[model samples]
Target chain A: MPINYYIILSLTLFVIGIVGVLTRRNTIIVFMCIEIMLNAVNLLLVAFSKMHHINQVATNPTAGTEAQLFVFFIMVVAAAEVSVGLAIIVMLFRNTHSIDVNFLNRLKH
Target chain B: MTIIQILFWLLSALVLLSAIMVVINRHPVYSVIWLIITFFGISGHYILLNAQFLAVVNIIVYAGAIMVLFLFVIMLMNLNKDMEPQKSKWLKLVGAIACGCLLLVLIAALKDIDINNQIAETNTGNIGLIENLGTVLFTKYVIPFEISSILFLSAMIGAVVIGKKD
Candidate 1:
């Protein structure tokens, strides 16, 4: 498959994520959108890894291995992020009784 | 077009549609469901690209574990109702337009890149296999791997601290 197609597809997915983050009032939905954006970047990274592999397979058999490992680490970090973020969201809801992003405008409460 | 090409397009359509649905759905539960679909579609793309390890990991981590956590939180918070207040029409329009413009700019900037002729190796790459990746992970990337474990530990402790009621 052409790398351009993957790039365009990933870009569209990322844009959709941005739209979700910008338009949604629900904090959980916004967090989900962030996950979507992360997935889009992961897909692009894997695609690029394959592209690099195809180009350099002659000299290096494991040409694109680093990118895939990077994706693995990304998943690790995202998991940790989600745990902490959701805990914060739950705490916010416990105090504010709502999960609206607008409710969080003021840092001083 | 080859079978691989057809499969790629199909997966791409599935991913994009489900991602949009994740944004459009009013109920957070439905959004979570749609996000799972989106993750599955991306996993299909990974399989197509022959990154078997990442595909399996994506499904297990994103679709299975992470999404379950999301659902648990949503249900615990009793957020199944459509209680999300709608943004103003103008604000939504502006957001959509901004995203569209960003997409256009990115496409324009990347359309004529030098990688136009390059192709991603699909259905035939040993580098994506688990054995090779495991060796590289334990050898070249061992330190970062250990650091990520510490990161997970800190995150766990932070969650516990923040989530504990006063």
Candidate 2:
């Protein structure tokens, strides 16, 4: 399979997520954008690793699974991120009664 | 383009489109749903890449577990509040400029590689054989593997501490 489509899609999705992170006032949307970015990078990494497995190298079957390994780490980290991030979001929501991120500008010293 | 290539292109389009919608959608629920669709499309990309184990894991962790938590957060929070900040026109302009700059950089970097010129082998569902993944992870990545659990533990503690209200 050509990796072009995967790369382009991942890049586009990542760009959009970055834009959302910067533009969206809602903190929930920012968190979602972060997820989107993570997913995009995961997709790209998997695609490239698969591409390497297909060409030049004889698909070591053993060595080529590194990307998949990282994907596992990515999942674990993302899981931890959600637990902590959402817990913070929930706390912020209780105190402020809103999920808007811009209002979190308390560091204006 | 061949049939598979055509299918890849189609799914890629769907993924990018849904991702855009996820960012632009006003309703919180709808945005999350678009994000789910985007994950499904990523899984399809995974299948194309012959990463069967990764594809399933992607769906399970990202599309399933993480998204459920995201939706839970959305539901737990009240949207109707006076404190919700609205985006100003200047910030929107700045965001657009940043996105455009990123697009230009991506295109510039990717232009050298012609994807069609490369002939990719057809290997499916065999890349992540359980033995293969287990050996490499156990041997090469042992430290990171051990360290990640600690990271998760700390994150758990942090969540508890920060979330506690006095």
Candidate 3:
């Protein structure tokens, strides 16, 4: 497939994620939106890596290996992030009895 | 049209639809479910691109493990109902408008890019195979791989510290 198609599809998913983050009040939903954005970027990276690999196949058979590895590490980091983030969210709910992002405004005080 | 092209369009549609549903679904549990579907759709895309390793990892990590964690948390908090307080209509409208403008600008900027003719190889490429990726990972990328383990350790400790009862 042409790279542009992948780019457009990824862009649409990312924009949906941004809209979710901006419009949603629930902190968990906002976090999920962030995950969506991350996945969008992941998809794009894979597409670009394949494009690069095809272009460089004669000179370098493993040209796109790094990008896939990078995607692997991204998944690693995202998993760790979700663990810590959910722990924080659980604690927040326990203390405040709510999960609304607006409830965090008191931190400004 | 080729089978690959058809599959690409189909997976893209599935991903976009599920992602939008994840955002607009009123119930948090349903949102999580939609997100899982979105992940599966993306995995299908990865498979179409011949990145078999990443596709499997995406399903195992994102759909199986992380989403289950999300569901568990939601159930633990009894958040199954649609209890999320609605934002003002104007605020939502503004957010949607801003995102739409951002999308418009990005499309305009990227539409005429020189690399649009490039084609990502589908259903081929051994670099995405586990053997090649493993060799590179243990050689050139070994240091970062080890550091990631340490990062995971730190994250584990941090989560426990923050989650413990005071």
lDDT of 2: 0.80
- In model 2, the fraction of reference contacts reproduced equals 0.74
Write down the RMSD of all candidates, one decimal each: 0.9, 2.5, 0.8
Best by lDDT: 1
Between candidates 1 and 2, the TM-score winner: 1
**lDDT per residue, candidate 3, A1-109, as tens digits?**
9999999999999999999999999999999999999999999999999999999999998899999999999999999999999999999999998999987888699
Give the least accurate 10-residue stretch of model 3 chain A, judged by summed lDDT. Answer: A98-107
Worst 10 residues of 2 chain B by lDDT: B116-125
The digit string of per-residue lDDT tens for model 3 on B52-145 reads: 9999999999999999999989988998465788899999999999999999999999999999899989999898999999999999999999
Tens-digit lDDT track for model 1 on A1-109?
9999999999999999999999999999999999999999999999999999999989998899999999999999999999999999999999988998987887866
Question: Model 1, residue A68: displacement in angstroms?
Answer: 0.5
User: What is model 2's DockQ versus the real complex?
Assistant: 0.66
Which residue pairs in candidate 2 collide?
none
Q: Against the true two-chain complex, what DockQ does each candidate achieve?
A: 0.93, 0.66, 0.93
Q: Model 2, residue A82: what's the lDDT?
A: 90
Model 1: which docking level applies? high
Q: What are the runs in model 2 whose C-alpha is more than 4 Å off?
A: A59-61, B80-84, B113-125
B3-89 per-residue lDDT for model 2 (tens digits): 778878888888888988988887888888999999898888777767777778888988888889888877767454444566888
| Candidate 2 CAPRI classification by DockQ | medium
Shift in Å, residue B38, candidate 2: 0.8
